[model samples]
Target: MKRTLTTFIATLALIALGAGARPAGAAGVTNAVAAAGTTNIVASSDGKFTPSTIVMHVGETTTLHLTSSGGVHGLVSNRLHIPLTRIQPGKAVNVAVTPSKAGTYVLPCAIFCGLNHANMKLTVIVKQ
Candidate 1:
């Protein structure tokens, strides 16, 4: 009876250890996308960026979270030197940017999505 109890305790300990051993990226799996501080931008199949204007303060750092609603898209900003981030349907992309001075920056979709792709413009306003 004592041997059985010891074996049961050892099994429980092994189970506990295994439960604590999580693989990389397992924690906060639901938070794989942008965090709370980043600005969210949604790219739609209709060739538009929702909330086309992003406001930020100069000398402040922030991230832009880009996601697609209906189809694949990308975010491009020549002034910010941001490379195109492929935003697949249901996936999110993040871009970190900091404006040194107060000004207006234009961000657009680098990929040809649809008819209104040329009109897909995102404005970034930095203020003092």
Candidate 2:
């Protein structure tokens, strides 16, 4: 009886741990975007942008395909002058960016996304 109880408790613990764990999709990603014409970025509920970094070439127009989950989110880059309005949840918004010069810029979430809003920064690197 004692051995059976111990085994049952161990099994329960394992199940509990597994249930609490989140899949890879929940966490932000690196190199998540493929191709140069358009890149897809998914804003997660945890206030993170998938494919945190965006790389492109100067003079090459790149369109950012943005989506949000859980709530509304907005993306904007002051330096790049990429105008992005409100992005509804589960809806996609596109913003075209053409950098004449090569530099690194940060695109931040314009709308409030929660406590971690400050962390929701997208790195944009333009190569010559």
- Models 1 onward score TM values of 0.67, 0.69
lDDT of each: 0.73, 0.74
Q: Which parts of model 2 have CA positions greater than 4 angstroms off? A: 1-36
What's model 1's overall lDDT?
Answer: 0.73
Per-residue CA lDDT of model 1 for 1-118, tens digit only, reads 9999999999999997876663212323323444555877777789877667878777677787777766677776666667778876645678888777788988777788888888
Backbone collisions counted per model? 0, 0
- Candidate 2, residues 1-128, lDDT tens digits: the string is 99999999999999978755533342233245455598877777677777788788888888877777556777876667787667666456888888888888887878897888888778889999
Off by over 4 Å in 1: 1-36
Candidate maximizing TM-score? 2
By summed lDDT, which 10 consecutive residues of candidate 2 come out lowest?
Answer: 22-31
Q: Which candidate number has the best lDDT?
A: 2
